[model samples]
Target: MRSIFYIFFFCLGFIGYSQELNCSLVVNAQQTGNENQSIFKTLEKQLTEFINNSKWTSRSVAPQERIDCSMVITITDYSGENFQGTIQVQSSRPVFGSTFNTPVYNFNDRDFSFRYLEFQNLIFNPTQYESNLVSVLAFHVYMVLGLDADTFAKQGGDAYFKQAQTIVNYSQQENYKGWKLEDGLQSRFALIDNLLSPTFSAYREVMYSYHRLGLDVMSENAKRGKEEIASSLKLFEAMNSRRPNSFLLRTFFDAKSDEIEQIFSDGPNVNIASVKETLQSVAPMHSGKWANIKF
Candidate 1:
C-alpha cells in the first residue's frame, strides 16, 4: 500500500514539470467601468489556469526549463459577453550559467476583441477556430515558445512559428480585426507573416547570435561575449536596408533596448562605433536608450 502511494505521488510530481510554459496572465477591466468585478476576476483565474496547465509542446520540460512569460489584457470596453481591448505579450529565457533571464519577445496586440461567459471552458483547437480569446492566447503561447527557442539555436523556432502561422491561417476567416492582411501592419497576421518570410531571415540570425553566442557566454568571458553581441547588432543593418522601420525591428528592441544598454554600458571595452551607428539608424525610436550606451 505504501509503495502504491509513493508511485502515484512520483507520477504526479513528474507530470507537474512536463508543461512548457509558466505564464502569468492578468485581465485588467478597470477601463470597462463595470461595477461588478467578479466576472473579470473569474476570467483571470480561468485563463491563467488554461495557459499554464495546457501542454504547449511535444517535448518534455523540467520546471526550470519552462519559458517564463506574461500577458496583460486591458479591457477597454465590455457590453454583454463582448469584450474589446489590447493584450500585451512578453516572454524571456534564462541565460546560460547564470541566474539572469534575457527578454526575448515583447508585443502589444491592439486589435483584441472576444466574447466569454464566466464559466465557459477555454479549450484550444489548433486545426479549427474555436473562439478569438482561445485562438489569441494559444497563438501568443506558441510565439513565446518559438522566440525562446530561437535564442538557443539557429532557426530552431521554425516549427513553433509555423504553429503560430497555422493559428493565423485558421483565424483569418473569422470576423476578427487582427487576423487578416488588411488589419494593419502590427496585427497578428503581419507578425507571423514577417517571421516566416525569407526577406526577414536575418532577424532570426540576430536572435541566435545575440543570445547563444553573446549573452550566454558572458559569465565566463564578458569581453568575447560583448564582442559577439555587438557583432550581432550589425546583422540588423542589412535587414534595415531592405525593410526600414520594420515591425520586427521595433519588436526586437521593445524587449531588448534596456538590456542592450546595460550590456554595453558596463562591459569589457570593445569597438562599438559601427554598431552604435546601426542602432541609431535601425531603431531610431530607441534613440534615447542608445544615447546612454557608453563604451
Candidate 2:
C-alpha cells in the first residue's frame, strides 16, 4: 500500500516515445518440459520481446501514459513442440493525484495451450488467423487497453474492445479452444461479449466513477473520494441485483476486494457497516474480508 504514491515527481524526469504496453513477462518451465529443455529459454526471450516491442494500438501513446502489465506463463505439460500451460494476465493504471496504481485486470487463465517451435518468430495479424499463442496474447493486450481506457472516459475502450472482437471473430476459423460461444460462461468469449453488450453498460459507468472519481481523488480529497467509491458500490449492488452473478462483477471483486479493504480500513468517517452490508450482499464469497471491516 505504501508504494501507491503518486508519480507526479517521478514523471517530471522522464520523456520519450514508448509503446502502449510495458509488459513484464515470464515463462516458467520447471514443472513441465520435454526431452530438450532449452526451448523454454528461447521461448521466454522471444515472448518477452514480442509483447514489449509490439505496437498494439495505432494511437501513439506517450511514454508516461503507457499501461503497466505483467504476464506469467506456467507450463504444466510439454511434449515435442506442443506446450500446455496457464497464463496469468494482470494490468494496472495510475490514480489521479495519487501515486497508487489501481489494479484493472487480474486473471489466471488455464484455458491456454499452444505449440511453439524453437527460435520461431511470434507473429500476429489482425485480419487473419494466427497461432493460438499470438491470438491469446493479442486478445489480452486489447483487454488491458480497453479496461484502462474505460477508467479515464466513459466507454472510451470501444475501439480496443472492437479489436478484441475482431480477433475472436478471426480465431473462429481456426481450431482454437477459447474463442467460441459454446466454450462456457467464463470463457474469454463471455468476458468481451459481456463488456460490449448493452446489458452491462452500468458496469462501465461504475468503473469510471470508481477510478476517475473515486480512487483518483483520494490523495487530494480522501473523504469525498471514498464516498464516491462507496456510492459506486451501491451501483454495483443494484447491477448485481438486476443481473445476479455476472462474470464482470466477479472479475471486479476479484481484482478489487483487497484494495477496497485497505482503502476503507480507518480513513473514512462514513458508515462502514452500511458499506459492509452492501459489499456482503453483492460479493458474499468475500465474507472473510468484509467480516473484518467494522469501524
Candidate 3:
C-alpha cells in the first residue's frame, strides 16, 4: 500500500510539472576564448533542460500539444562569469484541424547581459528578476504563451499577458536595459504594454482572425480562410490610420510578411490593388517586400 501511494504521488508530481514548450536551445560561444569556451557546451545542456522541464503554465498540455519553439543565444563575448549576447525567440503553433503550423511570435532581443557560474542552478522566479538570462527567458516564455493562446481564441491570452506585465513590473526594479520604458519604443516594455493596452485591440483581433479563422481553415476551405485573413488585414489598415507605425503593429508585419505573400500566391480572394493600397498605407515600410503581390 505504501508503494502504491508513492507511485500515485510520483505520477501526480509528473502531471503537475508537465511543461508545454518543446524548446530547442543553441548556445554559441564563438566570441569567447578556447580556454574556457567548453563551459558554454555545458550551459547549453543546462538551459535546454531548464526551459523544457520547467512548467510555465497551469494548462494541461499533452505531449503532442507542446508548443514548438527555438532559442538561439549567440554569445559574442564572455568574461569569466559575465556573458553578453543576443537571443532570438521563435514559436509556432499547429493550426487546428490542419497540418500547417503558423508562426505566432518571433523576436530578436539584442541587449542581453547576464552572469553565470558553471553548474549553478537557474531558479526561475516569475515574480522577481533573479538573473538576466532567466528573467529574459521567462519574459519571452510568457510572451510566446500569450501570443500562441491569442491565436486560438479571441483575446484568449489575457492571463498570459497580465503575467508578462508582472514580469515587466518586476524587471523595472532591477538595473537592466531591456526592461526600461526609456530604452526606446522597440524595448520589451513597449511590446507587452502595447499588446495589453485596449488601444491595440485591433492588433489582437488580427491575431485571432489571422490564425483561428484564417490559417486554420485554409486546408479545408481555402476561400473561406483566405477571406478571413484578407478581412483581417483591414484591422492593420485601421491600426495604421489610428496609430501609424506602432511598435506592435510593426511586429505583426515583421512576423507575417513572408507568410502573407505566400498565402496570396494562390490568387486569394482579396483584391491585389486594394491590398497594395492597404499595405502602403498601414505598413509602408514593408512596401518594397509587398511588390510581389502581382494579382
Stretches of candidate 2 above 4 Å error? 1-17, 33-36
Per-residue lDDT tens digits for candidate 2, residues 134-210, read 99999999999999999999888999999999998998777667799998778788889999887888789988999
lDDT at position 282, candidate 2: 88
lDDT of each: 0.91, 0.86, 0.84
Clashing pairs for predicted structure model 3, backbone only: none
Ranking of all candidate structures by their lDDT, best first: 1, 2, 3
Q: How close is candidate 1 to the true structure, as a TM-score?
A: 0.96
Q: Which window of ten consecutive residues has the lowest lDDT sum in model 2?
A: 8-17
Better of 1 and 3 by TM-score: 1
TM-score of each: 0.96, 0.91, 0.91
RMSD for each of the candidates: 1.7, 6.6, 2.6
lDDT of 3 by residue, 119-171 (tens): 89898886777887788888999899889989989999898889888888887
Question: Which is the winner by lDDT between candidate 2 and candidate 3?
Answer: 2
Global Cα lDDT for candidate 2 = 0.86
Could you tell which candidate, 1 or 2, scores higher by lDDT? 1
After superposing candidate 3, which stretches have Cα over 4 Å from the reference?
1-17, 33-36
Tell me the lDDT of candidate 3: 0.84
lDDT score at residue 188, model 2, on the 0-100 scale: 82
